[model samples]
Target: MNQVIRGLSVTTFFYMVTLWASFALFHAIFDKPFDHDWDLSGNFIGLFMVSVPYIAYGLILRHLENRPVRRAVQVSLLTVVCERVSIYWIGSYFAANGYGNPIPLQFIRGEAAPYFSIPYIFIGGIVSVLLCVAAAGVRWRKS
Candidate 1:
């Protein structure tokens, strides 16, 4: 229990820091916020998205400590891609139904419009994979 709490705390801290850093970089480069809506729903979704990479890297680091960097990177990338796809599917459902408070799907569409579009799934997936890989690197160094 103590270990779980510690892991979650560390993961959450890293996730938020990395997410904000990424957002800041994107904002500086594009002159626009990585995400526009700062409401409860939007914040929740952002939390979830950021946590995905941290959790993925944490789990891999926990179970596959002996794995080589190439293999670890591959697994982490796959995990992030899968997670992003699942999130997109859930987002699509919410968008279609007009459900949830303010709806995270709408925020995804509004802020990550280019990335969320049909033609950009691969690009987004690659970017997510890279982000996860980088997060894994940070976790590895910290541990």
Candidate 2:
């Protein structure tokens, strides 16, 4: 349990660092703040940004004496829950600060439900973990 918690902390730290750095780089190149919802490319990059942490998390836990699939599922569930909560909180903060919600307008307008995106995220997490496992050649058998 403690190991999972520690792994999550490290994963989250990397995610934030990568996110901020990506934003900074985009700003430097474009001479403007990156609006994550302003274009399709932004959304694609956002998805990639979210996936990278899951891959890292899987790699971090690969050495545990457990099944790879189990570890992968853990990484998926933890990341998805955290990601959803973080999005909601950030959107709320932006809205409260008069910057407007960062969440897509479709969600706010009832054209799409935010919760519906969970399955896609979960699928992405599974794929990311599997990629890490394959790339690292992590053994599934318990030690």
Candidate 3:
């Protein structure tokens, strides 16, 4: 129980730090910084970009450590959810912000994840599941 709480805490901390770091990176790179906006908040888009799939993958990995097969099922269901929500998020972000809409199925390199399309979410879930699977597979293999 304590370990689970610790894991979640660590994940959240990592997520937050990542957000801040990304904001910094954006400010450093782009002349027009975005984290300040409300309707088209870079922070908000970034939250979905980094955190949603990150947390989902983390949860899947945690479950995989305890129960591999069950976690796979969980990952599958999560993939579905990620696929839809992520697609919508990307579409809305691009539509409103006029940038960064191309995030396609990233499991395979060079695939285009177009805005307002199913593939955006599909990529989100695919990337998450692939990361979890690869990590868990390596760990389980070592054990």
Say which candidate scores most in lDDT.
2
Q: Candidate 2's error at 46, in angstroms?
A: 0.7
**Model 1, C-alpha of 25: deviation from truth (Å):** 3.7
TM-score of each: 0.41, 0.60, 0.40
Q: Which order, best to worst by TM-score?
A: 2, 1, 3
lDDT per residue for candidate 1 within 115-137, as digits (tens), equals 34443355545655565555445
Q: Which residue runs of candidate 2 sit more than 4 Å off their true CA positions?
A: 64-66, 93-143
> Which candidate, 1 or 3, would have the higher lDDT against the true structure?
1
Residue range with the least summed lDDT across 10 consecutive positions in model 3: 107-116
The superposed Cα distance between candidate 1 and the true structure at residue 47, in angstroms, equals: 19
Query: After best superposition, candidate 2 residue 94: deviation in angstroms?
Result: 5.4
Best by TM-score: 2
lDDT for model 1? 0.51
Q: Is candidate 1 or candidate 2 better by lDDT?
A: 2
lDDT of 3: 0.46
